[model samples]
Target: MLSTKSFKGVNVFMSRNLVPPEVFDALLDALKLNGADVFLCCDPSRHGHNDFHIISSPDHEKFEDLKAKGCNLLGPHCVLSCAKEHRSLPKQGFTCCLAMDGIKVLASGFDMDEKVKIEQMVTAMGGVLQTKASVDVRFVIVKNVSAAKYKWALNVLKKPIVTINWLYQCWNEHRVVPQESYRVLPFSGLTICVTRIPADKRKEIEKIIIQNGGKYSAELTKKCDKYKVARRWGHIHIVTRKWFDHMS
Candidate 1:
C-alpha cells in the first residue's frame, strides 16, 4: 500500500548489534505510524558477523516494511537524535542522522554484548555511536560508571554523563525525554504545592524553597504534594507562624 504517512522525505537508520529481531520490526512499525520514512541498516563500521543491512526492494514503499529502502535524497542535517529541542520531532522535521552518521554517542560498560545492545538501542532509536571519546561526543551512556571512561567524562571533560536508564526510559516512552527524570539531586525532584505565601513572599520564599529541595504548584489538585491556605479549602492544612518559625 502507498503510505499515507508523510516522511516529508526523511529516512531512519537501524543498528545491528545485540538487537532482537522483534524489536527491530517494532521500531520500524512505530516510526511508520508517525509518518516517518525508515531504514533497517546499521553503521557500516558494525559489519562483522551480524546482519547490518536490510535487503530492501526498490518497489517497496512502507515505513513498517522490513525491506525499507534508502533513496538518494534525505531531508536535512541527518538529525537522528530524538529530542524535544528544535526540529527533532518527526512531523516538524527530521535529519535522518541514523542513515548518515547517527548521533555522536559513546557507550561504556564491562560486558561487550551489553555495550552492543546499547548501540543497537541507540541506532534503532536514531543515534550514532562514536568509537571513542571526543569533543564531538554529545552523550556518554554508562551501565558501569566505575569504568575509567566514566571518570574521564566526569572529571576531565566534564561531559554530560547519563546512565543506561536514560536510554530504556526513552525507548519505553517512545519519545525524546528530559534527562532530569533519570537523575537524582539534592533538590532535583519536583513537588508541586498550592502555597499560600503572599504574592511577594511566594516568589522569594519559593525560590528559597526550591533551592532547598522543594517545588511549587499553581493548581490545587490531588496530585499536589502540599498545600498552604489562608482559609480552610477543603481538607487542606493551614501553615501558622509556628510553621514559618520551624522552617526558619
Candidate 2:
C-alpha cells in the first residue's frame, strides 16, 4: 500500500517522449493515486493538473538534471522510446526469455528475494548468471540506476543495463522488449523471424522487435537473425513459440 507520507514533498518526473502516451496516462494515474507529486513534461497546455507542474519540452536530459534536485524518476526504464508501440501485446503463453539462452547476466543492489528473482528471470530466459561484473557479463540488472554495477555497465563496459521491471514487463508481454525502454538495457540486440503463426500475430511480433531497437525483415534471408517457428528450418536458428513461452 502507498502512503502519503512516503511521497510527501517528493517531486516525481518522467520523460514524456520516452513513455508512450497511453502508458503515460496510466502511470500518472497510478502515481497520483499513490500521492506522488508527479509531473509529465510534454506540451504544457495539455495534461495540466492541479496536483503537479508540467514542463513543456521533450528534452529528456532534464530528467537527469532533476535527479540532482531530488526528483524521483518513475516511468518504464525511466526513458522515452523512439520506437513504435503496438496497440496490443504478444499472445499469452509466450514468456520473457526465449532469446536469452546461453546469455550471461549479473544482478546488483537487490535483496535476497529480489536477487533470487533475478536469477530466476535469467535462468528462465536461458541465460547464465555471474557473481560479479566481468567481460562475460552481457546484462546487468539493477533496481537503482545509481548502483555501481549499473553505472559500470553503462559507463565502462557499455553493456546492457536494465531494471528489474524489464523482466516483469517482458514476462507480461511474452517476448523480449526493446532495450531503449529500460532504465539500462536487458540485452544488446535481438532479431527474430516468425513462422506458422497468424498474419496478425506476425505483425505483433515485429512490433515487439522494432519497439525494442531491432530490425525486422518481411522475408526470411539466409543470413538474417533468429527465426521463430513451430518446427525447425533445417537447423537455421529457430524456436517454437511454445518453447519461447515455456522459457519463463
Candidate 3:
C-alpha cells in the first residue's frame, strides 16, 4: 500500500519542463496526493528552507541558481520513489543520475533473492526490469561476465552489460555512476581525443572514455587511438561527429 503521508511537510517545486504536460500533471497530482506542499514554480520566498526543486536535468539553466540558494535538486523519479516507498527519501545526488527513469534493464547472473532486490530498486526509481533480454532492453546487469547470458547480451544482442556493482553504487550514492567504469575493460588500452565538439558534449565523451578504461587527451597526441576530428594521422583513427552518436 502506498503511504499518503510520504511527503508530509515537504515543499516541492516542479519545473514546468520536467516532463510532458500529461506526465507532469500526473506527477503534480501524485505529489499533492502524497501530502507535499507542491509549487509549480521556484519561488523561494514562498517555500521553506528545506525545499526540493525537481528539474528535467542537472544541466537545466536554473540548476546553479537553485544550488546557490541551497535548494535540493532532484529528478522527477525521486518524487515517485519517495511516494511509493512511503517516505521522503534523501535528495542528495539525485540530480546527478537522471538516466534511471524509464530505463529498461535485465538481470543476467543473479539468484532469486538478488534479482528480486534489483527489481525492487529499479522499479522504485522508475526503471523497468525485464525477465528476458529483448531488443528494447537497454542494459543487462550481470554477476559473471563469462556467463552465457552475459555473452549473449554483449555479443549477440549487442546490449551494454554492466556488473551488479553498478546498480549498488548508484543506489548507495543516490547517483548513477558511469556504468562503463564497472564493465570488464570495455575500452581497455585505448587513448581517445576529442576536438571541435561542444564543451558539454566533449565533457560527456571524455568521461565515458575515461570510465571505459581509456585515456582522454584534450589535444591531439601521437598516442591517441581515436581522434574525433579531421586530422590526417596514419596511426590515429579520425572520426566524425556521427561517431559519438554511434558510440553512445
Candidate 4:
C-alpha cells in the first residue's frame, strides 16, 4: 500500500478535459490520499515553478506556451502509475511524449555499474541500447572523449557524442534535453578555419578543433559556402577571435 505522504511535496494541476468525471474523481481521491496538492485549474499566478500540469493532449493550444514557462506537462496515466507504485514513476514511460523512443544509444567509458544503470534507464524510456558502435546508433554516451567507442561514434559513425550527464538529465527530467550543452565535443558539427595566426599556432588550433569534435580546413570549400548561406539566414553564427578565445 502507498504511504499517506508518498507525494507530500508534489503539486499537480489536473485539466478537466484530461479524464472522464468518474475517473477524475478517483484520481483526485488517490492524489489526496497520497498527500499531493491538487489543483483543478491552471492559473499561472497560483502555480509555482515546481508544479505539474496534467494535460489532455500534447497538441493542446497552450502546450508550447506552458512548456516555455517550464511547466511540467504530463499525461493522466502518470499520476495513476505513481499512485500504484507508491513512488514517483519516471514520466517518460507514462507520457505521450516518449522522448527517447526509437533512439539507439551506445555507452562508452563507463564502469559496469554505470553501464547497467544506463541500459536500464534507456530501455525503460523506449530507447534501444547497443553494445557496440553501429550505423543505427544515433547517440553515444561517454565519460571519456578519448575512448575508442567515442572516436568511432564521432569520426566514423558521425553520431552525436554526449557526456554521461546528458543521459542522467534526460532520465531525471523524463525528456531528452538539448544536446548542445552536454556534448562531449562542444565544437561538434562545426568547420573551423583559422587565418592571420602563425603556422605553429594554427596547428595547435586545428588540434583543438579536432579534439573538440570539429573539422579543420586549410582552404574554403563548398561546405563553407553552405555555412555562409546559413549565416546569412541567421541560422549559424560567425564569431570573432575574441569570442573563440572566451569559449576556449
Best by lDDT: 4
Instruction: Indicate the worst ten consecutive residues by lDDT in candidate 4.
Output: 89-98
lDDT digits (tens) for residues 1-248 of candidate 4 = 45356777878887676554666887788788888888887754434545777765456776667767666666555566667667653433224334576799999888899998788667755678898768998898887654658668766898778888898788767688888788886565567766557787888888888877778877554455544655677754667778766545
Distance from true location, Cα of 18 in model 4, Å: 20
Model 4: residues >4 Å from true position, as ranges?
1-97, 186-248
lDDT of each: 0.49, 0.52, 0.68, 0.70
Tell me the deviation in Å of residue 244 in model 4: 16
Candidate 3, 1-248: lDDT as tens digits: 44357877888887676554655877787788888888787664533445777776555776666767666666666666666656664555334333376689999767899999898667645577999768888888877644547768877878677877788887666666787677755544456777658898888888887766667878765644334333455666776767745654
Better of 2 and 4 by lDDT: 4
lDDT of 1 by residue, 151-239 (tens): 67766766567767887776555455677655322223334343545777666656755654456555565554444332446654455
Rank candidates, TM-score, best first: 3, 4, 1, 2
* TM-score between model 3 and native: 0.42
- If scored against the real structure, what TM-score would every candidate get? 0.37, 0.34, 0.42, 0.41
* Residue-wise C-alpha lDDT for candidate 2, range 1-248, written one tens digit per residue: 43233334434455566455666766566555545565555323322222222222224554434334433222242111101111111111111324464678888878788887677556544466788789888777876554658668766878777867777776565456776577542212334566658998887777765654455656676654434431356754566777534421
Between prediction 1 and prediction 3, the one with superior lDDT is 3
Return the lDDT, model 2, position 64: 37
| Candidate maximizing TM-score | 3
Better of 2 and 3 by TM-score: 3
Pairs in clash, predicted candidate 4: none
Worst window of 10 by summed lDDT in candidate 3: 223-232
For candidate 3, the C-alpha RMSD (Å) to the true structure equals 14.9
